[model samples]
Target: MLLLINVLLASWFYTAHGQGKPCDYPVIKHGWLYYSYRGYFPAHVNQQFVYSCDRYFVPPSQRSWDHLTCTAQGWSPEEPCLRQCIFNYLENGHNPHREEKYLQGETVRVRCYEGYSLQNDQNTMTCTESGWSPPPRCTLVKTCSKSEIRIENGFLSESAFTYPLNKQTEYKCKPGYVTADGKTSGLITCLQDGWSAQPVCIKSCDRPVFEKARVKSDDTWFRLNDRLDYECLDGYETREGRTTDSIVCGQDGWSNKAACYERECSIPQMDTYLNAYPRKDTFKVGDVLKFSCSQGRIMVGADSVQCYHFGWSPKLPTCKVGKVKACAPPPQLLNGKGKEIHKEEYAHNEVVEYVCNPRFLMKGSHKIQCVDGRWTALPVCIEEERTCGNIPDLDHGDIKPSVPPYHHGDSVEFSCREAFTMIGPRFITCISGEWTQPPQCIATDELKKCKGSTLFPPVGKPAHMIEYDHNTNKSYRCRGKSEHKHSICINGEWDPKVDCKEEAQIQTCPPPPQIPNAQDMTTTVKYQDGGKNINSM
Candidate 1:
C-alpha cells in the first residue's frame, strides 16, 4: 500500500503537463517555497501547492503568508516580489524586526527603549528597491514633550524637556496656588504614551464666604490677582476696617474684610509739619478740612480735604524743603516759545506752557511742569515740512491720494479711467515738493498701431483685436503666389510675415534616358491624362 501511494503521488504531479507527462521540477510562485512535506503538487497549468517563506526574510505580519499555485490565468491572483530591500544599521540601532534583508513592500517596526526617545523619528521602516528608507533610529530612553504636554497652572520640576522612560518628573504649583485636590505638588512617570496624567493647579481657598458683606462684581469664582470692586449703598460706607471701592484678589481670596455701615468721619490731622483749620477734634462726614504747612515747609500734596463716603478725599499734604532738585533752562526748540516766568527760581509744581508758530505742530509735551524742582519735560515744535503740491490731473484718468497734497517722501498713485490705460509710470513721488514722472492715460486698445491688413492677410482677425501691451498670433495663408503662414503682434508691432512658397509643379516628365533593356510609359488619372504626365512604365 505504501509503494502504491508513492506511485500515485508522482503520477499526479506529471498528469496536468500532458496526461502523465513529467516536468523537471514542480511549479510554484517565484520567491515562495512549496511545502512538499504535506503533499507534492503537479507542475502543470492550474496545479497548486502550499507555500511558505523558508530561508527568506520574516515579515512583521501577524497572519500567515499566502499559499501560491499555478494557474492558466497566470497563477490566479498573482503576487510578485521582484525587488527586495536591504537595510543596514550602525551599532545601537534597535529595530524589533532586525534582518539582513526584507522583501519589497514589507514593513518593519521599532520603538525607543525605556528612558530614550526618537528625534525626528523614523521608527517605522518600509522596504523599497532603493533600500529601507530611513531605518528606525531611536534614542535609548523615553521622554515627555513640553509642547505636547501641559499641566494647568503647574510647571514641571525638570526643564521643559525630554526625559527617560519610567523616569519620574515632578510638577509644582506657583506660590499662592495649589492643586485642585489641594496638593501643592505631584509627579508623573515618563511613558511611551507620555505622562499618565496632567497636574491641575487650582486656586487655594481657605474660605470663600464673606460675612456682613456680599461679594463684589457678583463674581462666584476667584483666582490670583483678580480684583473685586465694591459699592456702599444708601449713603452708607464700609466699616472702619473694611475696604470699599476695589479690593485686590489674592490666592486666599480678597485681601481685606468687607462690610457696610453708616458713613462717619473724624477731624483729620497730618502726622508732621501740618495742621487743619477750625482746630476741631472730630468732624462729621462731608466736612472740609483745610490744611497748611508749617513755616519753611513747602506743601507737596492736597492743600485741603473733604471727608466723603470713602474717607478723606486726599491724604494730608507733606512738608519738605531741601530734597528739591533743579533743572536748567528748558532745551531750545525751533518754532516754539515758552511762557514767561515770574519767579527767578522755578519751584516744584510750577508749569510753563510752550506755543508753536503758525503752520507748525507741537510734538512732545506742551507744558514743562517743575517736578521736585526738575522740569517735567520740554515740548517739541515740529514744522509741517511734508507738504507735497497738488498732483496734476491726467487727461484720461484721475489721481487719488492716501491723504491730501501727498507729503514729501510720500507717493501719489494714478490709475486709468474707464477704457483707458496708462502709457508711462503709474505713480509719481513728491521729491523736494515736486511730482516725479507721471504717466499718460490713453484709450484702451487704440494705442496699438498694427495695420489690420498687414496682420490678417486680407482675411481673418486674431482671436481678439490687437491692443497695446499685448501679445497675440493669427494664422494666415497668402492670397497670392507667396503666402504668409503666421503673423504675430507684440507691443503694437507685427512680426515679419513668414512666407510660404508652393512646391514647384512639374507638368510633364522629361524625355526618359533610355536604359538598355527598358522603355518609358505615361499614365494620367486626371482628365484623360490631359497631356500632363508622370512617368510610369
Candidate 2:
C-alpha cells in the first residue's frame, strides 16, 4: 500500500510540470544574471530574477542591479543593462550620429554652426565613463587678424595681435593729418569680413596769411571744412563791400581768397552859406577839408573837417549873423547872491561872479561872461538839507557811507557779509523826506525756496510765479514725447536730473507670417542659419 501511494504523487508532479510553458534564458550584454539558491533551471511563469551591469554601466533605471520578471510570452525586460554614457547635446553644434545612450569609448564626428567653432579646432567627441570627454561646446569664432592690417600715416593704440568680431580699437593719426571726420584719433571695429573702417590719415590745412585783415586765433592748424573769420583793418574793406568775411579750408587749400583793400569816402554835401576848399567828387581816407563862412556872416562851428573810413569827422561850420550890441545886467542867482554885479549895460566878454548862501551847494560855474549880445548861463544854488535820520541798521549787512542824516537825493549802497545773500535792490535812496525800501541780508542756509524761472527745460514756458517751496514737484512733457517728465525742488534749486531729449522714432513692421516650427514673433527675433554673420552700420 505504501509503494502505491509514492507512484501516484510522482505522476501528479509530472502532469503539473508539463502543463505550464517556461521562459528562455535572458542574454543581456554588459550585464550578469543572478540565479536563485534553489537553482531552478528554465524560468517558469511568475518567476523573478536579479541582473547587475558591468563597471561604469547601469540599467535603464540608472541602478547597479534590477529585477526581471518572466511572463507567459517571455521575460518582462528583454534587455536588462546597457553601457550608461548618454549623448551630450551641443548648444551650437551638430552631431552626425545621435543616440539615447552611447557605448563607452565611442567617437562621433561633429561640427559647429555658422559663426562658431570648437576649442582647438577639434571636430570629434568620445563617450567616457564620466560622460562625453572634452565637453561639446562651441565658442564665437574670431574673424580679424592684426597681421593683415595696413595703416597709412596712422597706427593702432592697442597692443593686441588678434581681435574677435565686433572688437574695437583706438587709432591715432600723425600730427599734420586727421581722420575723415576731422578728428586726430578714431575708433575701428573688427567685423565679419574685415575691419569696420580704413585706417588712413588725411592731410590738414595750416593757418592762412592775410593782407590788410586780422583774425583772433592762436591755433596754427585746422582741419578740412574748418572756417576762419577775419575782420578788415581801419579804412579797408573786402570785395563783398563788407569789413568781415570767412574762409573755409578745403582738401587742397582755402576756399576763398582772404584780402582787404583801402577804403574811399564820398565828397560831403555843404551848407548854402558855407564854402569848402579843394572840393572833389570822392575823397580818400584820412583826407582833410577846410571851410569858410560867407563874407557878411560869422562862423558858428569848426572850420576844418577830416574824412574817415565811414564818413567825415567834425561837422562843417555854419554861418550866422553877427551881434553889434551891449549886454544887460547879470541875471539873479536862485538861493544865492551875485558878486561883481556892476552896471546895467556891459561890453562883450565882460565877466560876473556869484556866491551861495550858508548850507547851500553851488551848481554850474561860479562865474558868468557876456557873449555877443547875451550873457552866458547863470549859476544856481541848491539847498543842502538832510531829510533822513540815521540809516536803519541791518543784520548780517552794512550800508556804505554810514554817516547820517542823509541828504535828499542821496543814496547808500548795501552789501551782505560773506556767505550771505541779499534780497531786493542793492541800493537805497532818500527822496521827498523819506527813504526807499531797504534790502534784506538773508543767510544762504535760510534760502530754501527756488525762484520760479524758465531756465530749466522741464518748465515749458516762462514762469511768473514768485517762488517754489522746497520739496515741490513739477511735471512737463518733452518735445515730441507723449510721456511727461518730472522735476523736484531741493535746497533752493529745481534739479531736473534728466535733460529733455527728442523721442526716438521706432520703425513699425507688419506681423510676421506663421513659421512651421518657431515661436510667435514679437518686436525682435533671434534666428541663426548656416550663413555668414552680418553687422549693422
Candidate 3:
C-alpha cells in the first residue's frame, strides 16, 4: 500500500509541475551524446542534452554538435547527424573547390581538365542533404568545333562561327559556277559526325556571245537545263518568225544557236483604183509608200502608210467618188454625259468622249466617232453595287455556318478537313464588301486528332478511345440530365467546352386543369422553394 501511494504521489507531482512522462533513450547512428547521464535508462521531460558527430561526419546543421530537448512527443530533432561527402578523383576533370569533406547545404565548382570537357558544358555542383547535386561527370569532347570554311568559287551567305547539330547554312556561287542541283546557291547541314555536304561550285555555261540580240537575264553563267530568253535588236528577227526566242543550256553547251536575221516586210497589196509610188516586191521596216487616186476619184483617209514591226501604220487611202457630208448630231447616252454639249452638227471623222456619273461603271468604248456621216454605237453605264452574294467553297476546308449578304466588317472562321493542315489565318474578314485572303488546306501526313475529355461523352458512344478529326464536332449531355451541349475539334484543339456537372434537384408540376365549358380561363402561378404552386385557372 505504501509503494502504491508513492507511485500515485509521483504522478500527482508530474501533473502539478507541468512535466511530461519520461522518454526512451535514443540510439544515434555514427554519433553519440556529449553528456553522459550517470547510469540513466530513460530521460526526464524538459531535459536538455548535446549530441555530436563521429570522424568525417557532421550534424544536419553543419555544426560539430547539436542541442536537443525532451518533449511529450520524444526527443527533438529525431535524426541529427549525417555523413560528410568527400570531393576527389574526378575522371577527366579537376575539382576546383579544394576541401577535405563537405556537409549538407555546401556547394562547389568543378571544371574540365585539359583535352576534355563537361557533358552539357555546366561547371557548378552543390552538396545536398543526400549527396552532390548533379554528380560530377566529365566526358570526351565530340562536338563539331568552329572553323573557317573556304569554298573555291563560292561564299557563305551568313557569317557565323558556331554551328550546332542539324543546323544549316547557305552558300552562293560566283559568276561562272553553279551548284550540283543546277542552282546558284546550296545548303549544308551539320551532322552528328561532321558536315553533311561540302560547299562546292562547278563550271557551267560560259558567258553569252551573240550579235543582234539582247539576253533577258543578266546572269553570265547558266546551269544545265537553264533557259535564257533573248530579244532581237532593231531590224532583226528570230528564225522562228518571232522577235524573241529562248535557248536551253545542255550538258555540252548551249542547245540552240543565238542567231537573228534582218527583218523584211512582205509586198503591199494595192487597190485597183489607187496608184502607189516606189513599187517593189518586198519592203523593209520604216519604209513609206505614197498613194494617189486614179482618174477623177477623191482620196479618203491618210495619203501614205509606213511599214512597222506590226504591219502598216495608219491605213492605205481609198479612192471614193462622192463628197463627204456633215453629221446632224451625236446620240445621247444613258447614265453618261458627252463633252460636246449644245453642238447641233458634227463633221465626218469627228470624235466625242463620254463619261459615266458617280457610282456607275462604263462598258464598251467610251468614245463615239462619226463615220461616213453616221455615229458609232454608244457605251452603256451600269450601277456599282458593293455586297457579297455567296460564300465561296474551300478546296479541303470548311467554314462555320454563316448567312450572307455579308457586308463590311464581318468575319468567318475556317478549318481544314481530316489529313490536311491549314496554312494561313483561320479567320477571314470582309472589308469593302470583299473577303480577305482565304487560307489554304494542304495535305499532310501529320493530321491532328482530338481526344474527348472524361467530363464529356461523345454522342452514342463512350468517350474512352474516341478520337475526333480536325474540324469535326460532337454532342453530349450532362450525365443523366436533359441539358445537351456540343464541342468542335479545330486544329487538334477542342473549343467551347461542353462539361458535365452535378445538377441541383428541382420540383415541377403539370399544367393546371381548365373548367369544363368555361367561356374564358385565366391561370395564375407562384414559385416557392423551387416548386411551382398554382392558385387559379
Relative to the true structure, candidate 1 reaches a TM of 0.27
Worst 10 residues of 2 by lDDT: 519-528
What lDDT does the true structure give each of the candidates? Answer: 0.57, 0.70, 0.69
State each model's C-alpha RMSD to the native.
37.5, 28.6, 32.7
Model 2 accuracy (lDDT, Cα): 0.70
Q: Give the per-residue Cα lDDT of candidate 3 at 232.
A: 90
Candidate with maximal lDDT: 2
Q: Following a full C-alpha superposition, what root-mean-square deviation does model 2 have from the true structure?
A: 28.6
Off by over 4 Å in 2: 1-143, 204-242, 250-297, 300-309, 318-537
Candidate 3 lDDT score relative to the true structure: 0.69
The per-candidate count of clashes, in order, stands at: 11, 0, 0
Write candidate 1's Cα lDDT for 236-266 as tens digits. Answer: 6675544455666675566875556656677
Q: Model 1, poorest ten-residue lDDT window?
A: 520-529
Cα error of candidate 3 at position 199, Å: 5.2
Which one wins by lDDT: 1 or 2? 2
